[model samples]
Target: MQGVTVVDHPLVQHKLTIMRSKDTSTASFRRLLREISLLLCYEVTRNLELTSKVIQTPMQEMEAPTLEGKKLVFASVLRAGNGLLDGMLDLVPAARVAHVGLYRDHDTLEAVEYFFKAPSDLENRLVIVVDPMLATANSAVAAVEKLKSRGATNLRFVCLLAAPEGVERFTKAHPDVPVFTASIDERLNEQGYIVPGLGDAGDRMYGTK
Candidate 1:
């Protein structure tokens, strides 16, 4: 994919396999998600701009590399996104947070936004949108569109799994924003679910239907 990067790290793939199993319990699934997100977070922020800053270490004063410009913003797409959000925050505690609430309309497989909140200084920061699955790309696209409307120019999308259909639609819709995922599954089922994907991420995480 042109604008997509599939994180094929060994640990990421290993954890994803466990998460994809139907027998995995909610507690275990959530735990593995948080753990994997930490690894994914490492890859997503790999290219962040770095600037040297003077700092006093235990040994002596030295210039150390630190993230440049404004702090990062992780814009989570509602409930499922929070699974990725928790671990991302664990890695970047000082990073700001944003929430874009959206749900899939089963019949149309379209996103319907119910709530949205974010920092006012969106244009100054790099926003990384997080969601566990990019099945239809409806929610991911809508969330990014909403953020851009609020002045977020630099943005990236991160998910645990993505469908080829979803990736194509998402990239075509917002070619400027890059995508990071653990895997691009075979295809999306008729109900807009990623085939052979870990079933409904939100449901599995929360033990809901």
Candidate 2:
């Protein structure tokens, strides 16, 4: 609640509702995630700093506002995060891309990283880490930690859905990083799944389940 910002735009809400439905087809759900992610990108990047640069617009040379500093980085938390990645890239086409592969260790309920690759200039740019679900916060927290280990300082987290428990834990672990989500669901179920969440995002999107 403290650092979390919900993107409650009408289009986002509409798309999310479609995604949450059990009757939705895999192709339809994937399409909706891509569409909703574009809206979330708008909210998450709303405050990016702008600078003026002289440019000729047709007849006159005038200053034009453009994003300042290095290009942003979209660090997707693998599999499901990739669903948001395509849409986010649609908005910031010049932004760099990174992937962090992590999975929850069922017994220990801890995040285990299998792969990580990022741009070399992560320290100089804003990094927005994305995942579709933040149920237990294990994977999200670990992914952010791995990014920081690679010199990513200016970071933010984005998700399609999040549980209150996950949000609290994520904010407490990294208060400096802000979070953006389309919705905050009631709570997580006993199996560490977000209640009423769009099922396993990866499975649903790719039809694995």
Candidate 3:
């Protein structure tokens, strides 16, 4: 997390600009999030190990590369994380999925986990915990802790956006997990929302607000 992967690629930045505007429609925002998620997924999975194999191409036989193992798991940090899931799944369609839900205590800013589900053998799998935003690191950090306690070892975190404070807190808490985010926004507000964030991800994505 110290070297949190922040994607500043032009396309991602452009779509993020669209997301930030107050007038962006739900359909447009959803499409943009999916498109950007696909791009971001490409970056996040770049280092996955590959094994060589003989295969038949359209023209002729050739050596091909495939994933080294079948130990991948995709864990979402709840409602908003669902938006990022489809895109990541497009890249890793076969990965097993898990979900964790955490809500904040308005006064204390602490995370309260109300729901959690995951693969039983999490310790041996390559877990990718994804969420749309990393704001204050409360839910983010808590989710990782829960995953670890449940036996997740090889873990990677993916997000659409992040705040410096959140990233710092997360890395300090779990240095082993590398983080991937499309953009790192400015500081967090008193309520822990990333400044200039795309409002509430869950609210915006589902038209709850």
Against the true structure, whose lDDT is highest? 1
Once fitted onto the true fold, the runs of candidate 3 whose alpha carbons sit more than 4 angstroms away are: none
- Model 2 steric clash total: 0
Of the candidates shown, which would achieve the greatest TM-score relative to the real structure?
Answer: 1
lDDT of 2 by residue, 8-109 (tens): 998899889988999999999999999988999999999999999999989999999999999999999988999999999999899999999998887877
Selected candidate, larger TM-score, 1 vs 3: 1
- TM-score, per-candidate, Cα-based: 0.99, 0.98, 0.94
Candidate 1 lDDT trough over 10 residues, lowest sum = 188-197
lDDT of each model, Cα atoms only?
0.97, 0.94, 0.88
Per-residue alpha-carbon lDDT of model 3 for 125-167, expressed as tens digits? Answer: 8998989989888888999999998988899998988999999
lDDT of candidate 3 at residue 184, scale 0 to 100: 87
Candidate 2 TM-score, C-alpha based: 0.98
Clashing pairs in 3: 123-151
- Residue 62 displacement (Å), model 2: 0.9
